[model samples]
Target: MTNVRKGVWRMKRELYKLLLMVLLAILPALSFAQGDPITQARIFVEQKQYEKAIDIYKKLYDQNPTNADVYTEYLNVLIQSKDLKGAEKLVGEQQKMRQHHPLSYVDMGRVYLAAGKDKKAEEQFDEAIKFINGDDLMTQQIANAFSTLGRDDYTLKTYERARDILKNPYFYSGPMSRLYAKSGQIEKAINTLLEAGPGQQGMLEDTKATLLEFLGTDKKNLQQAQKTLVKKINEQPENPYYAELLTWLYTQRDDWDGALLQIEALDERNKENGDRLLEFARYAAKEDKYEYAIKGYDAIIAKGAKLPYYSLAKSEKLGVLFAQLQANYAYKPSDVATVQKEYEAFFAEFPQYYTSESIRDYARLEARYANNPQKAVDLLTKALEQPALRKDIAGRVKLDLGDYYILTGKVWEASLLYSQVDKDFREDLLGEEARFRNAKLAYYRGDFQWAEGQLSVLKASTSELIANDALYLSVLILENITPDSNFVPIRRFAYADLLTFQNKDKEAETLLDSLLTAFPEHPLKDDILMQKAELAEKHREYARALTFLKEIHDKHAEDVLGDDAVFKIADINERYLKQNDEAKKYYELLIVNYPGSTYVQVARNRLAALQTGTPAIP
Candidate 1:
């Protein structure tokens, strides 16, 4: 019997030990659950420690009975803890103190709603809405309190009551429209936002932004918005706001023609100096709506050469013509001749443009498209002699002259010109571009070490484009150098890249394919594909280019050229293929997948413009 008693004591000790260990483990969790007083109270409630949470709330309420934040928090804790009587007393005291305030009524209604007393809750909410005066602050507070309680219907009622008291139709339009949209009342949302008068022009942008958020590329919603805008325009014929909104709606639907027509009507009605027309044309040109852009520019030109915008119109029209020609991959020699005639006429009329970007673009046309590098060289050389040319323009022209020299086989002369610009603008973006060109010339000649050295220094350039290029070239060099110093593959690739730059497309393509055929498993495969894509793009073989880009994006997505491939694909779709939706998808993919890419910001901007149907204004 003694041994049995001893065994029983041992068993009891082991059971107590297990129970103590369990408590010790949970004690840390309990302590960790106790954060700030309110957080601790909420955590305790979530853990079903309602009594403890109520005690914390009761203390908090006693410490700051009149504070709204504290009062709301304490009331929420009580309601969540199902302490209905405590919640009633808490809100009742606030009502007695703030007899004119409507939030107290809202709080009481929330408590009643939690208790399933729907009729009582309705009555309390009604009483709160009646307490709304003409005070904007009080009205907003009441509306927000109701919104926070998930009582959107009462929230709408509160805003409507305030609007009636203020006698303003657009008083709560912003919030009310959002509420209506959230509740799937599309027509009401559109109408409520459009109801604002001319006096509310300051809120126009905000109203548009709200519409963008809710309407969001939905075909039916966009159509409804268009109808509402049309109705508003008709009702308020003199209001430019409605007309502008309607034009923007047209753009959102990709209806550039309609947008241009609307802008033309507005300009004519207002008897403006083609300022609005010019702005609209510039936007359209940026969006690749070349036909409408030309029409808009022609409208200004037709206003006569004596007008303020006549010369500007002529100059910009020449640029648009060049851009149109460049965009047309199937453009004929006649197209080039036609645009060249426009440039000659503009330069003949305004010799001052010899110092502008127009001159550089003209030179590019002669050298690149017309295959007359000598003419380009002579043109830029004469432009450089002009005394009125800005220092920067002179530098840019020198760089272009260098490129033309390269095209004309004046390799040493090209080097000299690049070096001159590099020396003159040693601290500018122009200088950086000059340096990159020199390095590229070196790479073309298979001087990899020197080119890599120059590129390494430029890897941190202030210009993002130059820095990205430098980094890419630097990485390519380091990646392709073999252990035994074999340079056959990379040398051929660099030469092919140079050939592509020189517009020898067939030779470049042949060399790239030979490199791929010779070295099937080379690290340069992706780079070769990228070069091939560039060659295809230059030739306007967009579908073929897309196939190559897709290969890189799929096979080398984690490689250095992955984002480049994606961005190039998007660019081709947006610029050459006219596939805006597809472009948006790839841009979005770049943003989501390669957030660190140098192209992310550009991708984001492009994506935003595509999604919002508006270009980002500089």
Candidate 2:
């Protein structure tokens, strides 16, 4: 009995030890199930709490050294955090766990691609594809991986394989066409699109339009570009852009008649407002059809819609009519006179509506053609009095009045007018013009010394025009005059003349003042007045010159310079001012009143030139 109890006690001790071992195992498993570090890490990783996830993963890795899934999760979390070194170390561990596994290679490739190591990604993808199963999904994944590497050839091959297996070739047609186009094989691209058949014709049309736009500006490439658009236009003849392109092409070739024909065709098809009328007007004007141009202007005016360019067009047409009348002056004097009267009537009707410059032009015509210098001067003077005249116009009128004074042989009067103008607008172009004329007036009176002195100052004038004139006249005076000359008044007049020639008008004017002040009763007073008129002529102040000449005949009729001034008025009106009729009248007057005048021969030659429309020798 004692032996049996000992044996039972030993059995009970061994059973107690086995139960304790089971309890230990169960307690560890229950603890892991309740609080799994790896599960917590995965939850953190999913929530994008990477740092906490990484710490949990590292703790799990230390505890479960042989768990491949834990190693993978840790690596992925490191990769998610962009911890490349940690991810790489985890990848090495994964390789040991699953040698040559497709998932392992793909994961590595994904990591490499994310890191922008494209070559490494490509190598990994290539190795993964070699071991890939031939399932369509697997094949697609491999093909997509090749596309990410930008390996065009491999991508195409993979796509072709997909197409062969899938048997829906159209599925890849669009992408393949784009690829072909990108490779500069446009014809192949077109073929690919056509293979997709009529269902894709809309897409084909879009492609065609894009290609045409790209090639349109290249004339050399245009010939080879397929005329799909022309074909499309023939198929739909009423397309507006097609018609417009054809018209543009005609314009490019300068084929105005052809362009007009196309426009007529367009009009026949539909009566839209097609700018054809304006084009026709421009064409007729180019062909010198003043009457037709008037018709065009009238058409636009009749519309009464206040178009943007209506005023400008009407102005151009009126100008054209005036030009036509002026060109026929020699052959059709009556017609010219009638046209001049019509223009006058037009001005009378719309005097305040036209631009001041246009009104001034009309006045000039009246002066030249209607033998109405007083009327012209009156109009210009009235315009000048109105503060509405532009600065330029005001200056021009002043210059014109000075011209008239010189023309009438009132040289002193003309000089005073020019001086007043110079002072009023000293920095303006008109001021420069006035100064230049004053200097020339001095030169005309045999006052070389005065003219030269004025010219010398004018050489430094602000205007290039004044400076050029000063340089020219200064050189002329220096060459003409002797050094140390003693004829004081004559020298002063000569210098003033030089100033006028050089466009140093203000200085020439001052010299003229000094001369008049120094010798108010000198015998050359009439000569000085005549010189002013001559200066006006040199400066294109014809009307001023005429006024001066007329004054010489009126105020100092018996003086030799007075006779000379009257003859000069006739000569300048005909030759320089382009007032042929006025010139003819002046020449006739000189012949009638001064038969022995020195300008008769030249006047006769000028009369012949005007009658025959040829320039006569001076």
Please give each candidate's TM-score: 0.78, 0.36
Candidate 2's residue-wise lDDT over 1-618, tens digit each? 699999999999999999999999899888887698777787788899999999988888878856868876787788879998777666766667777555566667777877889799768756665654446676666666566656555555655665666676565666666666566666665455434533443454454454444444455433323343345447667765555544544544445556566666674476543355456556656656556656655555554445554554555555666666654424355765765665666656555533366656655565555545566667777777775677767777777766655544567887988898899888776777787888888777776677777788789888866897688667655644656534677667766765564355667767876887888876556666776776666556778878878877787776656557766776676556667787778777666776676666766777677677765632
* Candidate 1, run of 10 with poorest lDDT: 609-618
Q: Flag regions of model 1 displaced more than 4 Å.
A: 1-43, 55-74, 81-94, 168-170, 183-188, 218-224, 329-334, 445-453, 471-497, 507-533, 540-618
Model 2 misplaced regions, further than 4 Å: 1-299, 302-312, 319-342, 353-355, 366-372, 408-413, 461-463, 483-618
Candidate 1 CA-lDDT value: 0.88
Highest TM-score: which candidate? 1
lDDT of 1 at 516: 87
- Local accuracy of candidate 1 as per-residue lDDT tens digits, 128-199: 989888898888888888888898998899998999998999788888998999999999999988886456
CA-lDDT, candidates in order? 0.88, 0.65
